[model samples]
Target chain A: MISNRLFIRLLAFAALVAVIAAIFWSQNPAFLSGGNIRALMRHMSVQGLAALGLTFVIVVRHFDLSFPGVASMGAMTLGWLIASGAPFPAAIAGALAVGLVFGLVNGIAVARFGLPDIVTTIATGGLAVGFSYFYSNGTSISQNFFMSGILDLNDKRIIGLDMPFAILMAAAGVAAVVLHASRVGAGMYATGQNRVSARFAGIATRRLIVLAFALCGTMACLAITLLVASSGAANVTAGGQLLMPAFAAVYLGAALFGRPSVGATLAGTLMMSTMLNGFTLLAIPYYYSDAIVSTVLIAAIAIFDPRLSGLLNFRKAAA
Target chain B: MSALTADIPQRRRGADFLMRYAFFILVAVVFVAFAILRPTFVTPGNIHGMLMSASIAGLMFLGLTWLIAAGEIDVSFMSVAALANMVTAALVQDGQGWALASLGGLGAGVAFGLVNASLVAGLRLPALVITIATGALAASIAAAIGLGTSIALNNTGFVGQVLGLRVGVLPLIAVIVAGLYAVSWFVQERLTFGHYIYAMEQNRAAVVEAGVPVNRMLFMLFVLSGVVSSLAGVLLAANLSSGQPYLGTSYFLDGLTAVLLGGMALKLGKPNVLGTLAATIFLIGLLNGAALLGWTDSQRQIVRGSLLLVGVGLVVFARSRRKT
Candidate 1:
């Protein structure tokens, strides 16, 4: 029962992915080899986890620029704790707690104090990076910390799938169910669509915004855990680089699905990961890859958002 | 009812006075505090150095005020400035004349600014998102232009002399910044365009109804911002005699902090040029004081970040309180 627009968008995205894959395969014969496919899946899952959280925030019409900061904070906290001989479970819990606190800070500043979400989150992100640097003493966390049970979790693959990918799938499934089948999700949509009307209808719009940010924070923590396991060390810049790609993926998903949906986000994340992988295989410079991805992001917004087109037409008529 | 209205204006006047002077008073107090804490802080030489640093940020801050006043934000200016700096430095390194190289850099800025304006004003996309993407794109392009991290400028020419110019202990860059501020003040306070900007801030619909060229104004504002940012970048390269690709990164956050801390309310959408200047000076002083205290770079960042949050929070809370 898919609408024509949705079907076409999906078909277009699929064909685009197919073309990119074929191009990469031609460039490198091992591009789609089983080994490379698994690696790409793992990379996408790690990135997809962060994008999923960001999708919730973006759906509420707020930008959580601090998510990368929260991720870095979580990673640094966990790495420092484990290096300092804390139990693995305690370290994980501590990192999640840090994420929760920062998320709450962002939520309160934006939802309660009425500060602009982007500006507030950007400041908080700086604070989080500061905290990460302070905690790590401006150096990467010791690699000895990676020898713990957390690293084992990364390798606990099922069949040919990575454990992180499995976890990402489960999380995505849960998020899809929560967003599409729950009353709260409906409230979230209502709040995002029209805050004043949602409030008039007795929806706690502020609470929903705060809840979305909190969920984003928790997801950042989860993503950091996998990131630390994969990288085997926590650096101050670990999470900052993830923000651009994560944001691009979320917006790309919103464009494809005609809404901010978890499934669309996963698809966008996988597409982005594949493109990045292809770029690497083709030996494209990092800056060019970034420029290309960002251009794609702008293109997605322009092409998919009908309101933007309407605005363009309005401007033309007025002129 | 007459008496009630009379009392309302009086109360509003009181609040307005407080809003306008609070940050200025804070700047004076902080300056005095720092001077008292470190005698060297009050020295003319140190103060000159601080003002020289503030000049670069102040130039960017000037443009930001206009952009924010138009109810739009351009985070891309910093990257534009950086890219412009790189272009100028690369050209100078290749034995091109400094004036021609500087023009090339400014041209780059105008070009990027036009792109930004098209997306933001023509396409009517969210300024925040558009500017962020443009900033990233500009920075990547700057990096891709064969400037390996930094480019050293040939500084034996007129450009270098202008950069190193001084009147007594005062740097010429500070004089240029002061001139720019005066021009900004004149524009914001006296010009008909300034009136349009204020009107647009108060009510876009009303401004449109009044037949103001809103989109064109925005387009011009961004172009002016781009040009000024390019000027700042050129000066920055001359001052350092090198162009660093990541030069303007810190200024992005610092410029925002300066604007917000200077009492420019996000809700009110009013630009306070003088307040922004004061905030820039105060930030420079704070950094000077931090250096005197021997704080690490991380500590300085932490302080700046916290100060920005508090400043923004206070403004938002104050606005909400006034509403209630």
Candidate 2:
């Protein structure tokens, strides 16, 4: 007999397909045109990278509301460096470094200091925004990085596909390989599914938690690079607005892959990004697009075997 | 001194309460400091304006404390508030009765809450994830319904008449907000339902195992939240005399800040009503004082961030000491 899990998942995928089709049917049936498809891919890539990083931290059962903040900081640092006559590669490296340091701090606080996840991340996100604001002097950075030839990563396309998409896919591939094929992945999963059990199994639970955060931070850095490349400017609010969408993608993606895996999260990101793209193409009002996406997320999770949510209910009900 | 050390536990509880609530006190300190420094923050109009802006956010915080204390978070409360405002506006524009419109808005909010409860309690989704989804979805629906057209209540209609009536020294909206806090406090302290929620928060599984219908209780709380938020929303619409689609996002930050500042840590699983109320007022005072003092928006954000960090830091330290 087919498991309820399989049935629900199939139903979810079907719902996703239907939404995609409905969006295309309403707006531009030709949204499937090659050019539009490529553009959508690039859009998905930016969000997908951030979601991939978020998956690692979340799967370990920790919240990182600071991704957008960190990503924005990275983007601003990169853009600022590039504008200030820094070399192209150095600007990118500096951006990634900012993310790395922030991630380390987050990991240490969560692991060593035992700060609650959401509260800490929220506070850190504020700090990141503050740093970004100070760096940008409370204004949008409008100096064109593209104009200076400091960043060509966004402009370079391979086989009609944007370079950012390629870069994101490469990052996703590495995450997938490390998570699925390596022992570190197993440790991470063990820690997430059951920390006590993982500890009993001799896994260094705190180390795993820190590592997950670091990976997430690195992923966010990658996403910021793409976003800055696409927009060619950075501001304090550049990634602030992305917090909700990123949350949506992470949670909604978890509903799909049964956990936050690199592959499943990528699927969730594509589902959301393309749905938004398709809605815009079809001339669906912004409000309607929000409604449709929200419906899809809730329906996707709820319709999936009641058992999946049942476990969570048991804890909530019991507590 | 030796005797004092022996009484440390008793003394510390009082101290912890005081320190945990220092953010609220800090608000007064900030106000006084700003007044001394700039001499403008003490003006009556600026104080009233700050209180008024905070009352809108404060109304939602009172309800949210119960939900958060019960170990269920409804981030979509703000979305519900915005939707309630939008519906009220749309109704008034369409020539609907004011009373009838308010009822409809509350009903819609409760329905949204039910949806959230069903997903979180029935289907077992994490409150964080479900609330995030619902919050986004609710905002979208609100935006979709409003259709990018903000309805201003300035026209000679039922909403206009209701909104136009401001009580002397306090808007009707402000009065309604005070009423909400009173009701929320009563529900939190005087009711057995509040006790059950605290029990549920401490150990939801234990509460469920004791043969209580945890799902139903939690679901009801969410519905109650919807009602509270909707009431706030309708009042906000009347006060503002218009409904903006994205207006609810500010409430999200403000409500969360109020809850945390109020010293009700989610980890503690107990809702401190008075503490939260005090914190709400304090935050409003700080922001209002800052604005009056000619602090830039960025400077205000920095101060807000610093206050939040300090507040949470103190609470964490106090809680850890108590536990140990």
Candidate 3:
């Protein structure tokens, strides 16, 4: 159920996006081209899917810093499997399986053993990346990847949307259902808001925490795996660059909605991807994108924080 | 609950005692096994080399010890270090004296830390996100100034000589690090502020009720982290004879591992200077031994990651067992 306030804000955001799009289009006629739109979707889905996954962990008040590691491992697994004569579907499953295992370990460690979320994820992620490094010894795994049908699948369109976007939509649909319209979702939200009270209410907060993390890690990997298929080579360092942008998207969503929600995350992902896309189309130096991400991230979080809200009320977050 | 804990099975008590000493046992076993398997590993030259490599990360870990003890985290300091590193290198390249360059770098790090403290401690924002934001800013600034490349120091010979000052076969940096740890130990074990920081970590409400200044304590911890990290950057520059805009990040995993591994040792769930010091040695030894055994970089990293989890798991299990 969308609140009236959120609905109005969404409309206003759409207007802002439209204005930005017009400005970009005025600068470059190819800004709204079909191929460019597809390319943008492909790029956005990577951060989009990862940010969607991150929403769960953040809502539960936990962080999984291991996404980059796990995601790289997933991509590496796909590349490694394909290079070793494995069938494409089997290779995809292999990558997802690796993601699931890592996610499960992360959740179990945090929920069962009571480890800190940050360091545990960092350790596990590092372990995953270390393992990923072994397949090619720090080189990109490119053998047989081009000959595989992955590129076809990666670019294939389903209902006018690319494969990556299609996957993103399916995942987002599932997230929207599970996070908003389900009993377990409510329990998860309650757990995030107050763990002790959720436990007293018989919510099985630990199990929900585990579930949130498992889903988070798996989706993070899925996003990166699809992205690697698009890029055609899997390097151990490929996922490192995704952290700031994806994090910005998730936090931006949470700030927009007063808390993390599925739709807001998707919207935030769209905004971030488009902004980066615009930057690419413009004559801006590529290095400035990192600065832009940092600014947006700080601004997004700063606005919602009570200490800065008074300063922000006349500006963005008054809505 | 107290009465129930008064009696325990002898077998369980033995297990508990072993659990408490497991870190030392592991360290000893690894060291002795390495020495026996490779006699050359115990040579003074190799030990000195290890000590030399350990000091930079050791310095950062010491600062992190304070932050972690206060229940705060800084993902930004390394990036801040990178900023400091590049600033020093850039200034040195501009024909600045060593003192001026060092000050320029340390100033950048200090400013970054104070900003982090204000947002995290004053505004009560989440530390991770704020630090990450600041970290990104620092890295960006470093890259912008350094043109996204590394800068070599101007007076390499002189810088090396200064940082490499030795007294009676002991590198002055190592001595300084040890002295710094002694100061940390003094503050942690003997000072009221140290006790207050720990108490704040354990229970913020109780500390507030007692009218302790929480924000000031947080500022001190973060500033300490930033200052030490900045110094680590300078030492790192001397070690490498060059500084990259993103170089300090290479030490992040090493720093965190040492700090967390330390938490599982002497203090057993509490991050402390002695634990960081010992764990730093243990970590450097593990890496050194792996290299001596012809292990690949991947293999060393894999082992290090696994040990990190195991160490944290032991800390968790120890806490649970003690509570029960």
DockQ of 3: 0.66
Can you rank all candidates by lDDT, best first? Answer: 3, 1, 2
Clashes of each: 0, 9, 0
Error of 3 at B60 (Å): 1.5
Once fitted onto the true fold, the runs of candidate 1 whose alpha carbons sit more than 4 angstroms away are A307-319, B1-6, B9-16, B154-156, B264-269
Q: Write the per-residue lDDT of candidate 1 for residues B1-324, one digit (tens) a residue.
A: 567536656777577556656666767887788789889998987987888889888987787888887778888899998899889888888889988999999999999889888888887777876787788888887787753478765574677687579977788888888988998889887999887877886798899889988999999988888888888888887878888788777788788878766645322325678778887888888889888978777787788788778767766666676666
Query: Higher lDDT: candidate 2 or 3?
Result: 3
Give the C-alpha interface root-mean-square deviation per candidate: 1.6, 1.9, 1.2
Q: Which candidate ranks first by lDDT, i.e. highest?
A: 3
- Model 2: lDDT of residue B84: 90
Ranking by DockQ: 3, 1, 2
Model 1: native contacts recovered, as a fraction: 0.55
Q: What TM-score would chain A of each candidate receive against the reference chain A?
A: 0.92, 0.89, 0.93
lDDT of 3 by residue, B1-324 (tens): 567655877787677667657778888999999999888889988988888877777887777888888888888878888888888888888888877888888998799888888878877888888888888888888887777788876575455786678867877778888888999889997999888878877998899889998888898788888888888887677688787888866777888888877877766777778888888888899889988988887898888899889888887887887677
Model 2 chain A, poorest ten-residue lDDT window? Answer: A142-151
DockQ, per-model, please? Answer: 0.61, 0.53, 0.66
